[model samples]
Target: MNGTWLTVLMAVPLVGAAVLAVLPRRIDGNLAKQVALGVSLVTLVLGAVLAFSFEPGGGYQFTVEVDWISAFGAHFALGLDGIGLALVLMTVILAPVVILASWNDADPVDAAVAPGRSPRWSTHSFFAWVLALEGLAIGVFAATDVFLFYVLFEATLIPIYFLIGGFGGPERAKAALKFLIYSLAGGLIMLASVVGLYVVSADSSFGPTYLLSELQQVDIATDVGRWLFLGFFIAFAIKAPMFPVHTWLPDAAAQGTPGTSVLLVSILDKIGTFGMIRFCLTLFPEASEWATPVVVVLALISIVYGALMAIGQDNIPRLIAFTSVSHFGFIVLGIFVMNSYGGSGATLYMFNHGLSTAALFLVTGYLIKRRGSAQISDFGGVEKVAPILAGILLFAGLSSLGLPGLSPFVSEFLVIVGSWQYAIWVAVIAVTGIIWAALYILLMYQRTMTGPTRPEVAGMSDLKVREIVALAPVLVLILGLGLFPKPLLDVINPAVEDTLVFVDGASVEPVATAVDDATAEEGDN
Candidate 1:
């Protein structure tokens, strides 16, 4: 097919979305749920087909390039590396999970409240948007050209913003607006940097630009590079919702449906760290080196600070949201570590964390539906009634805690080891966050799954056959990847090695010395 597979992959979901808008949203309440599941299933299957045909350790496979905006030199370019392949696969897996998590919900609230009754329980449009989003996200991860990447990147915001604002609780509008403002601002700011980069080309030709590889080859001064790096980093930071810029996340997550929250935290949030790896590390190595220690320190703060806040949250969704801040901190730390282990771990962690966190949020959505609340206090020892649900929740919780023989365990372990080579202190500090993760996750489990059952919850129903079917694939992955990480590791290693080029060529001692200086200054502060 000569890379035509990529186009078809994207087109399937997009075409499905085009068909979706014409259909009703809900059918007898339950119908909306079924259609959403069906749409997501078809998308997932196409993604699997792409994966099954994928060649592991391949640098950039199935590339398709076509001129899109010729005057500006933009190309409709797409390709996948081993890392992109893994993430694309993970996103597909979670697409259905998000739909299932949202299954019990009726039509998008706005559709119903707009002077007309929501079409009885079909939610065909909702599935269409969700699937369309999946297709675009795959496009983002697969894009080989800078222009195409940015287009797909910005496009992701639309569906998610509508999903949250249209269907979420009363605070939905504010949450959606805040998310939009933050993300859009970040993207716009980076656009300036992108233009600036093109302007600096020797030929002063924008026509030969807007290509990722072309941009990567352009060299600028350290200061200019630093400024460019900031444009990209700030956007990813807001997306990562790390530390100071993180306030919007908890609100958005708490208000959005559980499925929406899963997409927010698992796949979308990853765009931030992925930026660091692709744009920051690859495009601005000198700037990355200069900024490494500072970022590592902030990452450490996120680890500790996010955990503390997670402990304080009464809302389950907000707790998960804060946990992302901490998790991203680890991802950042690993990126800054810039070693084989750190780089590889961070990439692998993205895959594992996506699956684990998606399961957590999606299942929690089901809990919210049954209990009519997201308050931790409202869900007491429901295992008495919903044991199947409880078991799934426990598996997800353990994954969050980095339990051994699970995906999180291997990735986090690699991150710590990779960082250990650079600064033992960074690893030591990062490890404390692990303890906090165990605390909040286990506490959530204890509160929801153990002890004497409440009257309301004791009557709660367990997983239905459809729900069980929805959850099985993820559970199998949890155990399968945990027991056999080698297959995944082998694929990731080649890409990780390629990324280590700049880092390996560097004088490690100077970098370590700079890091030590940075740490000592932080300690004094």
Candidate 2:
């Protein structure tokens, strides 16, 4: 049972999706949602069990490996390190919450559909896509075979494309198409690198193997390594959607339903930074170091640029989307800084951001559903009628901006502290993003939830029991992890330290300490 746990964890949701797909057409949407929720809940339990059974600082627990393509040496390999565990847990936790929050998003009743929205399928399809995505994402995170990882990574886009294109605002189709184009382009580029890895491995004395553990031992020329790194980096960047490649995000988030947006930004986007650590640094250490200067500058640009763009947005979802762009900058910054603090913080940030962002998107979705609009200007004094909704939104926003007591604050602090060790100027510049975060979050909150009650929201109702149930876990986790982040830190720190050791970027002595030592030596002389 322990041997098969990883495989079983990845299979459950997929099997549930298949069950939903083949069910009799006459079945109601409510039943379909219930099935999806049940599947996601089971996955959550499995994830928790995996967590409890895991040994802190253990390398790759619950691993599975089997040959799939013997000739090419590809294996159906999977493993979970601390970093992967954190993300896997987030994926499972959010899936049920999203399913519950999206309960009525694809209702069969025509009246429940928002204006200008034409769903391509019923609730069954929506829930199935979510389940399918969960299964594939789990596979992606756990895959230790580069070939397996690449396939699962590309496979994830299928469910997301439908989730965005099938049911959303008037621009859903266009947004979906844009997302598909960008993703396909990125995947195709990555395919070139995947092939190159095979070719490089074929030259190894032991012959070709796509297993990451084996491939990490096969060395290639520096130039070839750099080119291959570019191929993989480009794909992850597009997925990460950083800087110039980031245009697709705000549009997708704005057009998709809030549930879809949560999966897209919070869960799916982590693949980018995850790849940076898992592949770029671990597999191509020299290339990762060579590319660091450029990556850091881009991260800074993303930080300031994303924040500024977010502040300018009147559309609520788009505003949240841009904030993610800025937040991702911090994550990417932590990754390339080449130290334990930055790497661990970046990993923690991935988990914390998912909780905070999901809460924001879902709570805002409820508000938009009530008023039938997503424009900030269209909402005012929402707290007067729906205080629970307003209060939750405020809490989510504060978490987003990295308020001191919330989970995000800890991640941000670690990233900056790590950056300071890497370079003082880099840390100083990154700090400005926190200030920008305050502006965008507070401004959005003030304009939408704090003004005098508007006629449109005057009759708005407070959160329903179902909605509150959906958000309860997220809120609790946000507060819990914020206060006591030790458990996660313990798991994450070892993996981070190991990666830094692999990349030869482990933290060094502080400059202040070095200067003091030199001064003491001179005094002795």
Candidate 3:
């Protein structure tokens, strides 16, 4: 299991999806839902086994390598470093949550569709696509070969494309198309760099290798490396949907189902930052440092811009989407700051943000489904009628705002502290985004959950048992990890240190405040 763990972890879901795909269309939706749920649960268990089997300070455990495309020097290679493990955990955890939350999301009659539109696929197809996306996402995280990673990365677009287009609001088709175009545009741009890498490797003593380990060893001149870096960075930026290139997200989030939004924003978007740390920084360290000033500025802009947009959104799902944009900014900022605190925090942020955003999307999704509207204007004083639902929304909203005693705060603090070491002004400006976060999250909560009960929402039902079951784990993790993130940090810190060796020869320590140094000196005296 140790050697084959990653392969088994990835195969379970893909195989489950295939089985569901081949099942008769006349099969009951409940059965399909159960099968999907059961399969996802199994995957989650396998994920747990992988987690337990993982030796935390160790690098790249559960690795499997086999030659695939020898001409291009690609292989069916998979491995899990701590960074990849964190993401894989998030992916597996979110799979069943999304499946459960979306239980009725694709029902042609029972599920709510945007006015005048209907579900374009069966419930089974929706679940199957989700399973496929999960499997591909795991592949994306675990792939050690650059070409293998790229293939899995591009392959992810297919299931998600269908997930967005076939289900959710009336504009899903248009939203899905926009997502595909942006993603494909990015992928195509990265392909040039991929080819360049092959070209670079071909000329080297290694004689054509696409393995990340081997690529890191073959040093090209600074000019060629920077150009190659740009190709990959631009693709990741679009996927991260950073400022200027981020327009596709709100539309897709608003138009897609909550589960689709969760999978898209929470699990899928991590690929961007994951690639940044894994590919951009590791493979092109000098270029990364050279690119930092501009990248930091872009990250700052994304933070401010995304927050402001979220504050102004009338639509709930779109609002959540914009908040993710803001959060992704923090994650990206941490990555580029190039310190232990920033890198570790950024990696952890990928996991924490997934939990926070999934909670927000799913709980808000319940609201939309009940009210039959995603518009903020349609909901008021939901707490007056459904306190449980309102309470859960409040918890989710607070987590998004980086409220204390929640998971996001710890990671966000680390990023800010890390950024402060990089530049005081950058951290200050980044902090302002947290202010905007408060406004958007609190204002949305106030408007939708705390005002006088709207007549239409007066009889709104509270969260159902299944809804509670779905959200319970998310809320618990938010608070649990908030109070105690050491276990994760222990695993993540070593990986951060290792990654930093590429940029800085020595492990960069997390910078402490002046007061802390002074206090330590005083204690010593």
- Identify the leading candidate in terms of TM-score: 3
In the range 334-442, model 3's lDDT, one tens digit per residue, is 9999988899889999999999999999999999889988999888999999999999999999999999999999999999988998999999999999999999999
- Best-fitting candidate, measured by lDDT? 3
Off by over 4 Å in 2: 109-113, 508-525
Better of 1 and 2 by TM-score: 2
- Please, what are the lDDT tens digits per residue for candidate 1 over residues 1-525? 358988887777777677666655333545545655676677678777777777765678888889888766778988877778788888888888777756655453454443221322246655667877888888888887776777788999998898778767767889989999999998998788777666665354444577776766776788998998888888888888788888889999988777778788888888888778877877788888888888999989998999989988889999988888888888888888888778878888898888888888878877877786788888787988998899999999899889999889988888898779879999999999999999999898888889889887877888888777767787789889889887777777777766667553532222223446889999999
Q: All predictions: root-mean-square deviation over Cα?
A: 6.4, 3.7, 2.0
Per-candidate TM-score against the hidden true structure: 0.90, 0.96, 0.97
The lDDT per prediction is 0.79, 0.91, 0.92
By how many angstroms RMSD does model 2 differ from the true structure?
3.7
Model 2 earns a TM-score of 0.96
Question: Against the hidden true structure, what lDDT does model 3 obtain?
Answer: 0.92
